[model samples]
Target: MFDFIKTQVIGVTTPTVDFIPTAEDLPAFCARVSNPDNQKNFDTAAGLLKYCMRVGHWSVFDMSNIVIEIEAPRDIARQVLRHSSIKFQEFSQRYAVAQNFVIREARLQDTKNRQNSIDTENNYLQEAWKLKQEQVLNLVRENYQWALDSGIAKECARVILPEGNTMSYMYANGTVRQWITYLKVRDDLGVTQKEHVDLARKIKPAIIAHFPFLEELMEK
Candidate 1:
């Protein structure tokens, strides 16, 4: 039963975001910005919010609150931890056993630049690389499970898992200002891990939905 529970929780690819506002919910936030003090000091005219965001009056943008969670590979999660703005809660292998690993078709190593990669469109190479990863992952999982069954501590047993393991990452209560900072860096084309870039793109819509002004920032 515990194995089933663990498998069901960890073995999924679809990223889940909770409580992001729908189209109907956006007007309330607009209204809040239009009349922050109930005195209607500002005319609440068209393009007001965009102008504020452009000129760096981020206080109004700070009022927008959105919470999202991401399930990402451990390699990508490490890069994400560099963003100090967003609060995070992540799955701890020290406390719990890992149930899944992230395995992807290996990219061709870029010969021109040691830090870069090229697309591996060759089917034969892709298949061989994937098979190799799966075989290694199976061995790792088998050994990890044996350690657990033999009464080894989870904290110590987890050392056997590789950096590409899957983890549930929860990012809580990010404001518009912080979201802009996060997306700007992580969404860059030069980011080391493809997983980080992909996850950032996936989460972009939720931020744009609530804070359309951020769309301009994204374009930059």
Candidate 2:
């Protein structure tokens, strides 16, 4: 059972943005200069909102930073490290002992989040998963000891380990914009982990405030 465990940020570096609106030019700027619905102001702020609603000049949102450390089964780690720009480093199961690994105590399993199995009634699923984890952990210990005594190489002996083995990882989100895009897609049905959706929902407000172009559409 993975709990509402804490995540430690390991590293992060994000790009800086300088927006030079494409709509700032004469005709296009005038076209979207007013909130057409809100009709009064003609300043940069209103024009910006109107333009963002129309042409979506959200280039300034490219700047922001985020980092997260996650623990998941090695089966899951294989898929999560695919995003190209994200910086990643994950634990190696074969080399590291499971006893050294951290187990998350989950109160509820959000199957919607990350497509993982969940526990809705009294956390039974989490408990079962924990017991399974303990069994696997014990297997690793027994095998490792047996291999050591039998003089077998550690690498060769660990090949039989199961995929449910735990691993921890650190990923840096280079741009908050990139993550916002990720949130929109991943938080939606069919693509989201319930926990991830919750996290994305939590992150949404701050992003909107920092990058107002992203704000209106999200609000709508």
lDDT (Cα, tens digit) per residue for candidate 1, span 69-122: 776767767877778687667788888888977667567777877766777669
Candidate 2 accuracy as TM-score? 0.53
Misplaced by over 4 Å in model 1 are 1-46, 112-115
Clashing pairs in 1: none
RMSD of each: 7.4, 7.9
C-alpha lDDT score of every prediction, in listed order: 0.63, 0.51
What's the TM-score of each model vs. the native?
A: 0.76, 0.53
Best by TM-score: 1
After the best TM-score superposition of candidate 1, give how far the Cα of residue 78 lies from its true spot, in angstroms.
0.8
Q: Which ten residues in a row have the lowest lDDT in candidate 2?
A: 19-28
